[model samples]
Target chain A: MELAQRILVVIRFECRRGMILSRVATALVLAVFPLALVLLVRTQGGDLETGPRGPGILFALLPGLTCLMCLLLWAIPAIHSEVEGSTWPYLAVRPGGKSAVLLGKYLTAVAWTTAVGWLGVSLCAMTMRLSDRLETWCVLGILILLSALAYGALFVLLGVVFLRRAMVLAVGYAFIMEFLTGFIPAVIHRFTIQYHLRSLLSQWTGWTPASLGGAFHQLSLFSPWPAWGHLLALLGGTAALLAAAGCILRQRELIKPESE
Target chain B: MDGPAGTMILLEHVTKLYGTVIGVNDLTASLPQGAYGLVGPNGSGKSTLLNLLTGQLRPTLGRIAVLGQPPWNNARLCQRLGVCPEQDAFYPNITPLEWVRYLLELQGFSGSEASERAEAALEQVGLAETRRRPLGECSRGMRQRAKLAQALAHDPSLLILDEPFAAVDPLGRRRMVELIRRRIAEGKGVVIASHLLHEVEAVTDRFLLICGGRLLASGTAEEVYALLEELPKEVRLRADQPRRLARQLLETELADAVRLTGRDELVVSTDSPGRLYRQLPQLVDRAGVRVFELRAAEGSLQALFDALLRIHRGMKILQPRD
Candidate 1:
């Protein structure tokens, strides 16, 4: 009960601190950014129905760009802010405080990213007249949420393990692992978050060779497993990453060596 | 306050190593429930020892039990421990009221109780008026006071403060001293560490002096001085007839050496300060010297530390020869 109270306090603190108007505005803009791009492409006479690139662009915008941006802007910096500001010691010294703080901030990041990412996906899907396809919209929403959770947890882990350099390393990992390796037909791509997200999208959206254009054959991506397997893997991955982050935070000293 | 076994803090053969450098080496001590000043210069392992006792840092070797429980990851023990770190960083954008209130809430205090305690603690620290102002706008002294307020807001059993008096003015330091004295009077235990000797002495006479990652000494100032009986004491006197006083001091054999420091000042070195003090009046009367001021030149805390360091080094030098 006491630990729960502590975690609540941290949640309140982080949430309150995160309510900066400028940052919120930036998130709002980022949320609508993909929708505007899609509309611009459509107005420029890119036949949305016939173009092979339509679904790919939408997938990139809704789940790929949105998840990466939200995690980078919110989750990765959750713990980095404390270490940079030299405030870790104050929180870490509390009873169960370190883990509570980690969990609270992790929740904050997940919520922030999910809310913004959903806003982006919903607006994008609506603008493209895809709202009529209720199943596709629901699947996209779930995929956006799952992406936020997985990416948020991974970024939180990165932030805890490498305080100052977490941002650069996370960006690098996203580019190499999520973007580059995710589409490879090899089994190694299964380890990347993007693979699971794309797999789920392919399975849910039913992106056949015609919808995906010549790119599907060229990429030679593996067929996605059952949606339940993808869902379980994502959920299990988030929990494991979050737990790893908490465990490392509890055992490691909060002291900055440079400050010492 | 020392009951049969009410030891508030016990560090047995504790050592903390920061990579290759030693933070604290083989420190061992047991302190009862009361106020104790941990005094040392900067980089003298004062903060390291405080962090160890607070359970913020685990010892590389040995163990520490505070309030009968190990501090590392021990939430039950931490509930009774409050720490005011020496670092200047804080939630800079938040007001002291919100910051302290949030900290107390984390300690399991309900909303109203946390607010009440936070207000009271801020008031006790003399930050009542500007408690709502952002901490970034507060002066360094005010920030220090605010940090102290949060440390006390939870009403922990043992308050461990690192450099509590840093950046505080003389008046502020006095107020802090009074506050600490009040807490001790209330029977709460406190372990306050600082680089300044007089600041620590202002609050508690029971102290531990550390240097070079070692426990140089621990006790009252008088007791520490007692250990230096072999060292000659220097007393400076300002007299109307300084030369006459110096002559009388030498003639009476009360001083080992007498020298004129100024036109009206005499510096006398004596192996036996008690005998010189006892015979000083007669010596002044015989010489027709009117003494205006008299003080022990080498009785300050820094001087004591210097002497102890010299003695320690001298012993080290003699070890090889022996």
Candidate 2:
């Protein structure tokens, strides 16, 4: 069998095995979070205009934040879960086993989080009565996919690097690079996934600096490329991170200690 | 990367150290394709050696080659080797059939082929009736069979098992022994590591005795038992006149030392058991003693192992015959 076929097998079985009650509940909660947030703003009679609390800013944050959180739950502990469960050796002994497992789990994470993110954004768009509801849904859907792919690959790489502490390290990386540094109007912000995602959101939705008041408007000044440029960056970044993860996993000895 | 022809495994001065502790101390052996038992006490580096052969660990010093190639990260080599690890962990929610099928798929089998082979392997391990049951809910013996099924499902040329019968009952053990013997009959190599002497003895006569992470001896069962002849042996006898028979044997110098254990029983320790056995009837008849029972107590592998350990420690256990 080809490597891709083996990976597909892993994905098929893993997705089936991941349908336990706890994960199902977590997926439900992720999909409902944005809808709940939108309902809360509407119930409180907050402004839905083009501002800090507008639909554009709200939908923009949904994909990046939601996808990152979802990938943290799935991809950040991919290898660690196998090792802790004592199932890694069985998989590690197969031909192309490490790469197949990593890539399969990474794709599953992306697919899972992207679906959840899309559901959340679609429900939020419907709840807010936006003027350009279809455009808003399409842009957010694409962004959710890009964010899931990018962040899933990033967290999978972190998982291979720091087996036990991948979650803590991933959260730290998100806070420093995506949350804080990504918003700064400098060349360094472009290196963050959040920056390219925000750039694409602003470019696609025609939300300019003057119309959106607050730190959100500053995002437009740093992005100079067309929308396709940011899309390619996200896709290219995902591939690069995944390749690095595969190489590291192949070279590293990820066996559990003999005491286990 | 083929190794020397007919050599199943080759280790040259291999040593594994876990920080400050030694796991496998300077060990060297060359084993050909056949069924062999790796007998050792707990923490005696049996698992460590198995791991090294399976490419799970790198030796701290020296070299190891399995099937003519170094095992470390050798994916092609892995395709020819199957290992049933000592750890008894499995995904709790999936059935044995699903787990085995997934492992076969990872071995590059297509979905239909993997499922078919998985079913056949489970059936061979006598798990066909319960293959669909959740592994976590299965009995320890059933779960052990599931582990073996996954290893055998790949149909590798070599099987390395670490304590395969640890939690199995007598009947289950017999089934496993028969299954392993069938593999050996097919010319497939098998290496079983266990602390149970009789369990390994049932499957293979070739034995490698290890203690304190060192190779004490390696040969056939008869070769190991022949070592016991050089050591002292104790024989027990039931007689009509225990004291009279004991005195007669002592007087004739056939028994090194004899003690009357009961009204009609005596224990004798001897350095030359062959001479004692040959002359025992004459000595008893001369004393008018009727012997009812006679048994040698120190002719087992356990005794030989104990004697070897004693010799390894530089203890003087050999008795001189006069």
Candidate 3:
């Protein structure tokens, strides 16, 4: 079979298995988390209509926190879960089985996190009273999709590299690269996924750096390219990460340790 | 390069190392297209070799080929090979039908063909009624059968099964043995790895005895048994007038050493058990010994393995007289 068809089969079964009560509950909770935070702020009489806090909070909560958390929950354990469950040998024996499984699970994680992010952003958009609510919703929706794809590929690579401690390693990477380095106004920040995402958010939504003021204004200057440049970078980086993951998975022996 | 034709599996000094531990060490074998029993004790590297054959692992050193092609990362070769691993694990929520169908699809079978083949294979393994049940709900034996079903679903020419009968009951074991025999009769090749000697013996006469990650011996059951004959065999005899019987055997030169374990029982060590069996009745009649029980002390396959291990370790083994 073609590789794409094989990957689709994996995606189908993975999505079906994802519908179990526990997993569905977790997904729902993740989807509602941003909405819950938004409602809590609204109930506390916080002003979301003025200043940059509304878009900033929406970007951070929707694409920023939601995408990272969902990928951690799903993508980072893709290979580890199969090995731990002892189900990897079954998949590993098929033609192109290893690559099919990795790509398929990566796509599933992206789909899952993107859907959850969209739902949370939609819920928050409906509840919040902003002047440019539709534009904010559209921009955040696109960012969430980009975030899921980029973060999903990164976490899948981490899972393939560090099978046992993939989740821990992924969290550390997210903290160091996407959270810490991304916020710094240096050339190194451009290498982080969060940097392009922040650039896209500022350029597309008209939420100028001056609105946030001070140190946040420096981020805009560091990422001076138009929206397409950021889009190309995110998409190109995702493809490169996935390709590297495929190469590593093929070369590495993912067999479980011999019990004999 | 492709392997020599008609060779089902070929290995040349293949070695697999896990960190500092050796899984398969300098293993070399060329097996023809037929049924083979890979026999070994626990920690004997049977699973490791199977993994190497199925491409789940890459040998740390040397080379391996299955079905005329290298197995590692050889997707085309995988199309002709099926493997049922030792681990019994499956997605808990999916039914056996779904699981088998999914695997078949991964093998490139279309949806309809995969379903039809999956159903037929499940039925062949006596899991027709439980095919639709969630794997988590199935018993271990049923799950084991499901594993076999998936392996057979592809209908590959070569089937590599590791400990296939681990959790199967006696009746289920009988059915599986018959099924494997049927596959063999169809001119397909099968390699069954098991720690149980008799289980593999029932399915295939060709045996590969492995120990400590090394190939100790390989041939038919009788060929392996012939190795046991070269060693001294002890026979226990329970009879009245045991001392008289012992004296008669020693005097006749039929027994090498004799010891009285009880008032009525004597153990005899002999180099020629066949001759001793043939002449035992006459010796008993001459001694007026009423014999009650007689049996060889070390006649099992395990004893054969023990003797082979001894020889492999450079220990002395007795040679039969010409």
Candidate 4:
């Protein structure tokens, strides 16, 4: 086979074998999981109101929730594992280049993250089309996809910095930092990709967003483009982080201690 | 290996410095295509050398080329290289069948070929029956086999195995040795970094004996060892009149090679032990000497290894004559 073909084969193979499980994990959490959770909540609450003025809290279920959950729980373990399995050595040895390898996996994570997140939000949107909020839903969904790219790179950097405990750190940042300070002043909240994501979706979904924990009204912040601009910057930042991390990994001195 | 690339690996004054400590220093060696054993003690830098060669670790100084390409960051270079790390890190909740399969899959094997090769490779390493078990559940030896299996499944022309026998039981060691031996016989070049000299000496022809991150000696096992000399070779003589035989032998030129290690046992070191042993009985009979013990002093490989270690601890290089 030609060298380029071999490189492509390796990159695709890396994507499929490395992240397939994490993608499956993402699907379970973002799509089937929320569906199950909603059913369970409604079982005891006795029939959710779906007829008149029924699109109340259901709007909050769209766009950013599944993306956030998947990034936090699923992407955390996935990125952190690149080190643990000793698979990096194998990947580093291939001919396609580490950037290509990282790009392939990053693409896989983004696609899976977007697909599962969209799947759930689309479900809730289908039910809420009664309120003519399709435009709001569409805009919010695009914003979530953009925000996920930034978060994905941030998590990838976490993996490179903390090889063993990257998972714990990613999870902590997701559940704690993002969840806590996401609704502060635009300047402060800009640190988080999810803050911009929620800002873009909160009001249009008929759900209230509180970056300062109920301090802000429903999406009443400044326009969403600044957040969008910052999101793109984050996207570039993720790529840069991945490139730097890949370089470090390339030069890293791996002393493999004799096994027990 | 792209037609051997004429150079399997080369290290030019390659050194790895960790803080003030030196892992490898001003070391240089060129490796061609063949199965070479890297035999050394715990900190002999065998693993470090392998890491440097395979692109897992970069040298702190100098240059390294695997198959004529710098081993660092060049994924294209790695396509022809395969490495089995010494550590026993595994992905939990995954089977050996699945794990090795995925690793091969990452090497760009199609689904069917990857699965088939995974099975064959696992079976070759004696993991076929147990491949379905999650790696977390596999025993230490099994995990090692799984690691090796994945490395071999890629059919890399150069296979680097770091302490391949580590953590394996005696039986497992034998199995691993056979696998390595088989791969080598098939004309695949292998580099096994290990401390078990007996194991290595038995399987490999050429050896790189590393000490203190420097190449002490590289040769056959026998050539690298310190043979017992200067110590008199004790050849026991069975004599009737012990006093008379001792005086007779001591008076002659042959006495220089003789010494008494035990009563009734006189050890003799002769340029020709065979001639002396044949002449002893005739001399004993002629002199009316009593006879009892007859033997030669023996040397052990373990003692030789220890002596080499002691000598290497302070020396920069081993004399070729030792």
Candidate number with greatest lDDT: 3
* TM-score (C-alpha, index-matched) for candidate 4: 0.74
- Candidate 2 residues B13-37, lDDT tens each? 9998877778888888889999999
iRMSD value for model 3? 1.0
For each candidate, give its TM-score against the true structure.
0.89, 0.89, 0.93, 0.74
Question: Model 4: C-alpha RMSD to truth?
Answer: 6.1
A127-182 in candidate 2: lDDT tens per residue? 76676777888988888888899999999999999998999999999999988888
Pick the winner on lDDT between candidates 1 and 2.
2
Provide the DockQ value for model 3: 0.76
Clashes of each: 0, 1, 0, 20
Task: Please provide TM-scores computed only on chain A for all of the candidate models, following their numbering.
Answer: 0.90, 0.93, 0.95, 0.72
| CA error at residue B244 for candidate 3, angstroms | 7.3
lDDT of 4 at B125: 86
Per-prediction DockQ: 0.56, 0.51, 0.76, 0.30
- Candidate 1 displacement at residue A189 in angstroms: 1.1
The top-ranked prediction according to DockQ is: 3
What tens digits encode model 3's per-residue C-alpha lDDT throughout B34-97?
9999998888889999989998789999999888888989999889888899998778999999
Over the stretch B206-319, how does candidate 4's per-residue lDDT look in tens digits? 778787888876665556543333223456665545667777676655556555545566666665444556577777777787787665554454444555666578674654
Give DockQ: model 2: 0.51
Cα lDDT for residue A1, candidate 2: 49
Comparing 1 and 2 by DockQ, which wins? 1
Where is model 3 chain B poorest over a 10-residue stretch in terms of lDDT? B313-322
Candidate 3 pairs with clashing backbones: none
